[model samples]
Target: MTKTDQSSAIPLDTTARLPAVTYVLTFCIAVIGSNSLVLGPIAPEVARSLGTSVALVMSASAAFGLGTAASALLMARHVDRLGARRMLLGALLGLAAALALSALAPAVPALALTQLAAGVASGIALPAIYAGAAAVAPPGRESRTIGVVLTGWTLSMVAGVSLSALVADLVHWRAVYAVVALLAFGAFATLKTSRYRDAPAAGSAPWPLAALRIGGVKPLLVACAAFMSAFYGIYGYLGDHLHSALGEPVSANGIVALVYGIGFGAAALLDGVVDRLGARRVMPFAFLAVAAVYLGFALAGGSFAFVLVITFLWGLSNHFGLNVLIMRLAAIDPARRGTIMGLNSAVTYLAVFAGTTGFGPLYASQGFEMAALAALVLMLVAAAAGSWRLPASATPRN
Candidate 1:
């Protein structure tokens, strides 16, 4: 085992169980997370409403990613001392305001700005949410707790994206944003009104670069970036692609996205899937599975049914793989969990930024088929990096 993996090994101890109220923190996560994928379900309508092309409208998507990258890079170190409750509340409030602003945006530029604000809020909130889950977890249950909380993101895909798309089809796209605004407000209220307690963090700050210097750390980071780039690159364009390729309605796109979410949530919550089979065993296959699915989607023609199946399978495999990756990173340094996780978040969204921006024009020219092919190349790299570099010990339960 590499030194970092050795360093990251967690012990089962008699730690306190997480309080029931802490689950509110998870809802807060779902609301904030909706901001990231909101554009995916409604991009075409957003483009038409703003008098822009889907490619240009994607700039708003890029802006959200950039905003996330900026905040994560600048402020990740201080998250522990800042307190999870404080950061999460602040970010949720900002997200509510930003979503409301998006509802009223006059043009693509205005919309992009609003999304930028929303992205920054998400970038700040997510790491804190993960850290908070760990802080309150009962030792050995930390992984399960973090996984449950991540169900927030999964729910955002299923409930938030699908429901918003349904709402958008019924009304205007702006109404979708309005509903998100209301929900964000409701999430904030739940957190604020709950019997919340501030989880304590270590007195010392996280040094991400220090962890990065470890033998396996750099490879894992690369693997993370590559994985997200491949996954999100296609995901960012899935709805628009479906619309243009098959003349499918937004509701169809929402259904497919919900299926994808179902796959992810199901895999993440599967009983003893990770523990029995182990993450090391699953990770490589997941990496290859996502790549193959993307390639299949690229070649599958405009059959929405085919696309839906591929999308669902990709989500199932990819979410399982990502959970393994995240567990490894989270275990890298317990004292600096917040900082490491924050860096992980930055890596993820920035890769989303790169993939979304990089593939927008590619999708415009050679189509989503070529775009998926491009993402496949990155996924292959992720597979290799993760397979070869992450030590066996990285999977603790194994």
Candidate 2:
């Protein structure tokens, strides 16, 4: 093992078991979710408010996603030297400013710029938070803690999108950004009072100059990309699908988002399920569930409630499997947690961007059923590939 790996190794000790680390994880994940939901349902309204086109308003999401992808891959190397707490604080400050700017943006390009800034901040925050979790958690509890932290992001997506949509409907869309800024401010305050400290700098590994060469890292990145591609393909256009196909209102779609969020939260709580059932087994099953959900969605015949339930199940399985993979990566290279996580984030966001941008025209031209069918096939293929690539040796046990 590398020196940094030895240093990052957690003992089953009391200090590592403190709750403050959990608080930090929760706060950070919430920020991710809120940032994710800032667009979509509100895009049209934002466009109208800014005197621009919906397409232009939606481009902000793409810009943000691009920032996320680029920052994760490029910034992974410097996280150790920067310190997790300092990195997180800097990210938060940048995000806060971006939110404020986006909320008050007078033009489409300016809004996009602010969104990109927020995305960059979030990209940095993600690796830091993951590294911190690995640094602080007790041995064997990495998966569970990672699950809890990631659940915060899922919850934010569910609540943030739905709530922001509702708030935007009642008031101005700009108020949504303002609210996010305020929530982030509150989270920053909470983190300030917590006793969580940065990982010790001694024996820390310098950032890898090349791409990840560790066991499981490459395949893990591929799975991350594929999984997120399927995820974003469906979710990025879920609102339009609901309205255009099922004739559901924006508010109703928000409610559906809440249901999906519940599923993610439920799955995170079941992190131990991965430990008990084994990562290899649980991951393939989760991917299969996503495929099944997509199939159900394709055949739902526009049944709003049925589709909502399908989405919920999809969220549950996707989160469960993804968290298991994250835990595996952390275990394989504990010293390079930030770099590994950053790579994962980069791949995932790249997939998301592709799904969002590439799938749109296809969906618009082919209709929801065809789009859903394509996503289903892609997910199933991803599941098969993941199962095949993952060796039997890596399977986890309760």
Candidate 3:
């Protein structure tokens, strides 16, 4: 395993902190993150242009999630052997190509294929980015460093979707994607030249998925998957639901994206709270909160104000809860941190696929709230399951 003197790296919590590198990588993280919300803002436009139903149009989200999940399960381990910097550059290039192809897609099937490509790239990018963060972070502030960087996901929701919405209105939906593609390309170019370190590890290790079979690990994964299913399910269809309820002739996708993002961006500070409470103690309640907000969103109807509140709470709890779970899981076997991080990414995206896929027909037939009610049931189960086995490593550090 490679080792570096801590004194050589930037102090993570210093008054004059080293945010440039973190922020640059964070920006790259945000670029890939656009794929997660890209279809949401443009769902209505994509359906109309491609001549498909809303449910069918949104299937692209499922395809993307599935691709990401598959990559996480099938290919993420390569991040360790291949090196994070190389993997990141490769993934970003692939993502750019996928988005470019998505811009020119003539049919829903073509879109799905390209989205799958993008998802796979994203799946690959995540672990590399996280590993890169750990490599660069100072010793004492590992959790805090991760928490700050994760805000990129939330930031993507705010910036990527909101801007894409407005851009789609003025230019073309394809144009919005083209711009995102450019951002990805630029990030790739910058990252290629930077000095970010690779994740240090002993010579290649076996794939670590079997580690999940250990005592507290399996339950945490299940609880995490269940919790994620509920959160991602509501978010998948949030745009279409908003468009239908508002009765706006034009899709106010920008407005919808912006409002949801506002909640998330504002709530990005929840990382501090999670740090203090410890994930094991706080995650179950956060999952319950996710369930409640999603349930409220499903029944919100014309009450735009209620939707706003629900969106904010959804951002706060899910981000905080999920981060805690991953951190706790990584701590379970520090030696296998890289493998566990990859598996966690796989589970997260796969749960999103489950949520989007299973909930689509229900969302079509019964509306978003009813589907949310189903997700709520799953969240309760996750909460209960989580209560059964809190890992000793997960005690609050604060």
Instruction: Report every candidate's CA lDDT.
Output: 0.75, 0.74, 0.71
Candidate 2 lDDT, tens digit per residue, 1-398?
A: 23222123344332245356776677777877787776887888898888889988888988998998888888865566667777777777778888988899989899889999988988888888877776766554555677878888776877777677778999999999988887777666666677877753556554543546665677666677777887888877877888877788867777777788888888876776565554556667877888888888888838887887787887787787678667655656555677787887888889987887778988899887877887887777767656654355643222
- RMSD (CA, Å), candidate 2 to true, equals 4.0
- Predicted structure 1, TM vs. truth: 0.82
Q: What are the per-residue Cα lDDT tens digits for candidate 3 across 288-312?
A: 8777776777677457667666766
Using all chains and alpha carbons, the TM-scores for the candidates as numbered come to 0.82, 0.87, 0.82
lDDT of model 3 at position 5: 19
Q: Model 3 segments beyond 4 Å from truth?
A: 1-19, 43-59, 106-108, 237-256, 292-302, 360-370, 388-398
Against the true structure, candidate 2 reaches a TM-score of 0.87
Off by over 4 Å in 1: 1-22, 43-58, 165-174, 195-200, 206-211, 237-251, 276-281, 298-303, 360-373, 388-398
RMSD of each: 4.3, 4.0, 4.8
lDDT of 3 at 346: 87
How big is the positional error of residue 121 in model 3, measured in Å on the Cα after superposition? 1.1
Which of 1 and 2 is ahead in TM-score?
Answer: 2
- Mark the 10 consecutive residues where model 3 has the least summed lDDT: 1-10
